[model samples]
Target: MHRSVTAGAAAAALLALSACSSSGSSGSSGSSSPAASASASSAVTGTVTVFAAASLKNTFTQIGKMFEDAHPGTKVVFNFGGSDTLAASIVNGAPADVFASASLATMRTVTDKGDAAGTPTVFVGNGLEIAVQPGNPLHITELQGLANPSVKVVLCAKTVPCGAAAQTALAAGNVTVTPVSYEQDVTATLTEVGLGEADAGLVYQTDVKGAAGKVDGVNFPEAACAINKYPIVTLAHPSR
Candidate 1:
């Protein structure tokens, strides 16, 4: 009778231990399922591409860095060039999230094609400047100085924003300058001046600001009459 009683207690103890182990395993499995689901849901990280005007390269780069710091999981990619070219590329279905142009004319090209998300906002304004090599070796003093037959001048192509602004200023002053080269973008024009390939080049004041010690900026009165405003827009159907 004592042996039977001891056997019955041992069987009951074994059943309790098995039940406890099954319950603990079930609880752990249930907890790990939610963790796996959360990880799957939170895995979203990629790059946002932006096509901006050449003049905006420096400022936008700084802004991009700040944006990346604010959004740790995302990256910012930039394609900087002439506003007209960027607008044309967006119209042709280039993958870009943001479009920033140096002139309204260029923005219109994108908006007219119904590529822009909304009306663009003017974020900044820039004026034209005559950029010369460090030390102004050519002694260019004013806008009319560019007309000097001996001066080698570089200008932006008329389709570009800087070129349009330069045209307005020159027309306002009634000064005609025959440029040695008409660059496709303001950066190219500035590059020519920085390299001393051209005696002077018309570029945005901001470009000169970037060159800092590499070039000397001469502010002429005509720049006030032809200041260009920069506008930025997000595409309606941006490709990720």
Candidate 2:
């Protein structure tokens, strides 16, 4: 799914201010305090739209609420989905102010298109883990356990960050496990395990954390090799 920022007018205002500031005298007080205050107040009364990877849904939503509270009348809206899909949308002219991708590859899509405001920053790191129903019902232990034909496994599609990490981990362990489904995102893969639709699934540690009591997480040594870094960027022409 793709979500676009709806603050088109707000963004235009901000951009106008930025352009004016760049051309006006740096020592001018008119462009200093007023512009800064306007920029700050923009967040206080309007909306800021963010597009993030599915794995960041819980954490980012919590942070967004805190941000809104700090700014009183401001609202923070988010669109969460696969990093690849989100990048594609942004490059295609989606109105997004901020973007947080699960992997650098996806973030590059926006940067490559000259759509980013500034250099992207690494905000977080996550490692792969096996998610299963509570109580270890399947007796799944290591990555190799996924190969058990009796165990129904689900994994993210190769184009998604989590799926690529899972593939690397599997390669490190030299095990090829067949999955019943290829999810579009890590959260979807974890959801399948939580729902008991699959015996197990490979997902990010952060995803399992968000699932809370819905699933159990098992750590494997190979996951260290599959650690993923999340990157965030502010678009060059934000729609506020």
Candidate 3:
């Protein structure tokens, strides 16, 4: 959700699926928006199970509902989790119709396994930020501030894209941070800051935005080096 688009048009374009012919191999990999638009116009019926990154929970949920509203009989179910975990599940034979990852590294796991019908597409981009308690508590203004021993910071595990981005940003600033906890996903990292259990957490900008009054976000220049590109792909074998 880095670059917002009209919900209807964006949803259609993002989930644009090539029409599946009698031969299962006939479906296009959806390499471009025009192709997706063309396929979206066709009446698509049946349920689609989407495995997506944890960061896309709110946006994708809205898109799923809109897609269902537009296509009455087409159901959109979702499995939201850390991108790496979701990718591993798909590569391990989990039945999912779509795979949307927060980073290209995770998407490669699926494409490299030949689980995707075609190449994955970059739909959106996001950047990392520091999530702190409201009222500017601890007054964290930059990446190096989190390195303070008293900051009580939290971060996503290295296995996740957010964690990877955090590391890159920290490296860019030449800062070393030791978090109080390592979360499995972005939401969990945000939760620590929201509940005041931790003074700050490294999460995506969208996550901080969603937190509203529960937390405040601090933007640092180092985050520019850690911007993440989201990728989505249609799975080769879907279980309906």
- Candidate 2 residue-wise lDDT, 1-240, digit = tens: 112323442343233323332232111122335654565445335667788889878766776776667566556678899999999999999887778888888899999999987777664577888998998887888999999999999999999999999999999999999999999999889989998999999998877877888999899999988888776767865653
Q: Cα RMSD for candidate 2?
A: 9.3
What RMSD does each model have against the real structure? 21.8, 9.3, 8.2
Question: How far out, in Å, is residue 114 in model 2?
Answer: 0.6
Q: Which stretches of candidate 2 lie over 4 Å from their true place?
A: 1-44
Candidate 1 off by > 4 Å: 1-45
Clashing pairs in 2: none
lDDT of 1: 0.74
Best of the candidates, lDDT: 3
Specify the poorest-scoring 10-residue window by lDDT in model 2: 21-30
For model 1, which pairs clash? none
184, model 1: CA deviation in Å? 1.0
Question: lDDT scores for all predictions?
Answer: 0.74, 0.76, 0.77
